[model samples]
Target: MAEILAFAGSNSSTSINYELVKYTASLIENHKVQTLDMARYPFPMYSADEEKQKGFSNSLIEFKGYIQQSQGLILSVNEHNGNPSGYFKNLLDWLSRLERRFLEDTTVFLMAASPGKRGGIGAMGVVQDILPRFGAEIASTFSLPSFGQVFANGEIIDQTLKEQHSEALDIFLQKLN
Candidate 1:
């Protein structure tokens, strides 16, 4: 079975993106899904001076190890002002420092969600383009727009959106096998 690591790019305790990622991960069959809450890891802002003074944090190292060990990754990004949340970006910066090509060649199922109609598309688009340069092999991508209206009771409410998500999930699962 594929060991998939799932996480949201936001550090909010009640993040919709985290809920979306958890739901998507649960749909996969015959897989061990490990979910990460970025809030649990307290990381200082990335700065060259900080790096030179304090070196890498243990949490960053541990997070990197999890990424390295996982067979696949499921990431749902939360957009903050048309960009990745500060928490997620900081983690990415730290990971890049650890390994310039950290996600290189790793299979990733990318997704995003937001309360707005655009569904965090801006952040998702940026990630889709930039992640590959850092070594992520995107297997599939999905977006849930107007998250409050489309998701209910821990599942997708709109039939059409559900179908679209299912299709994306199917593709991601195929890659896992």
Candidate 2:
């Protein structure tokens, strides 16, 4: 069975994006799912001066290890001001320094969601553009809009949106098999 790592790109304990990622992971029938919360694996703000002096933080090292071990990835990132959250971007920078192609050979199902209409598409674009450079094969991408209205009880309630997400997940799972 493939081991897929699922995570949210935010530090908030009550992150809606995290909820969306976990819910999507549950849709997969035949995979081992490991969920990561950024709040637990905290890292200091990255800077050139910091790396020059202290080297990579243990948290970043552990994160890279997770990426290396996983066969697939399901990540949902939150948008802050039409871009990915600064914390996630910082994590990306640190991971890139550890290995240029940190997600090499892994298939990724990228997703984003928000309470508003745009549905975090801006943040999704950031991941879609960058992950490929790191050798991540994007199996599919999804964006959930009006998160509060469309999602309930840990499931997507809107029929059209649910079917769309299901199709994306099917494509991703096929790549895993």
Candidate 3:
């Protein structure tokens, strides 16, 4: 079976972005989805000094392994101050240190969502702009606005939003095949 790595960019225990990623993974067919929590695979706050002093951590090695082993990715990021949350940014930094094109040619389905109307669009914009540089073949992207109103029972509830999300997921899955 094809494998997909699904993750949220937030370390919050009750992360809505995590819920969104899990829900998105559920929509995929014939794929084994491994849901990754940034909190579980913790990494230190990245810095050039830290890299010079200690080199890459074991967690970062394993994290890169997960990315390399998977054929596809489903990710939803949380926004903080109009950017990706700090922990998520740190993960990216560590990953870059390990391999510049870690996500090269990997199919990616990117998403973002929030309680408000803009949905985590700011963070989503950042990921969309940067992932391609890592050689990510972005298959489709979705941003869910007013997440509290549109999502419930572990799934997207609003009809129009659900349809739109489903369309994007279908496009992503098609590209995976």
Candidate 4:
């Protein structure tokens, strides 16, 4: 079975992005999905000086190891003022320093969700452009706007949105196989 890494780019305890990631990951069949909670793996803010004094943190290294072992990744991002959440950006910054090609050749299913009408497109766009530079092969991209209105009870409430999400999952799964 294919192994997939699923995570949301936020650290909030009740992160809507995290719920979105989990819901999407569940759509995959015959795969082992590993969910990553950014809140659980907090790290020191990234800095060149800090890296010089202290080597990569154990948590960061462990997280990268998981990425290396996974066949594909499903990432749902949260936006904070038209940018990636600090927690997710910090993690990505640190990981890039450790391995320039951190996501090299890995298939990625990129997604974003928010309560706002634009969803988390701001953060999603940033990742869409930058992740490829780190060698990510994006297989699909989906954005769920106005997440609070579209999602209910841990699933997408809007039938139309749910169908689109399912289609996205099919694309992701096809790429995996």
Candidate with top lDDT is: 2
lDDT of each: 0.90, 0.92, 0.90, 0.91
- The candidate, 1 or 2, that scores higher on lDDT is 2
TM-scores of the models, in the given order? Answer: 0.97, 0.97, 0.96, 0.97
What alpha-carbon RMSD in Å does predicted model 3 have with respect to the real structure? Answer: 1.0
lDDT of 1: 0.90
Q: After superposition, how far is residue 85 of candidate 2 from its true place, in Å?
A: 0.8
Cα lDDT tens digits for candidate 1, 39-127: 79889999999999999989899999999888799999999899988888888898999999998658899999999999999999989
lDDT of 2 by residue, 1-177 (tens): 899999999999999999998899888877889999877877779899989999998878888998899999999999999999999998888899888999999999999999999999999998899889988999999999999999999999999999999999999999988
Report the error of model 3 at residue 169, Å.
0.4
- Residue range with the least summed lDDT across 10 consecutive positions in model 3: 35-44
* Ten-residue stretch with the least lDDT total in model 4: 21-30
Each model's backbone clash number: 3, 0, 0, 0
Flag regions of model 2 displaced more than 4 Å: none
Candidate 2 clashing pairs, residues 3+ apart or interchain:
none
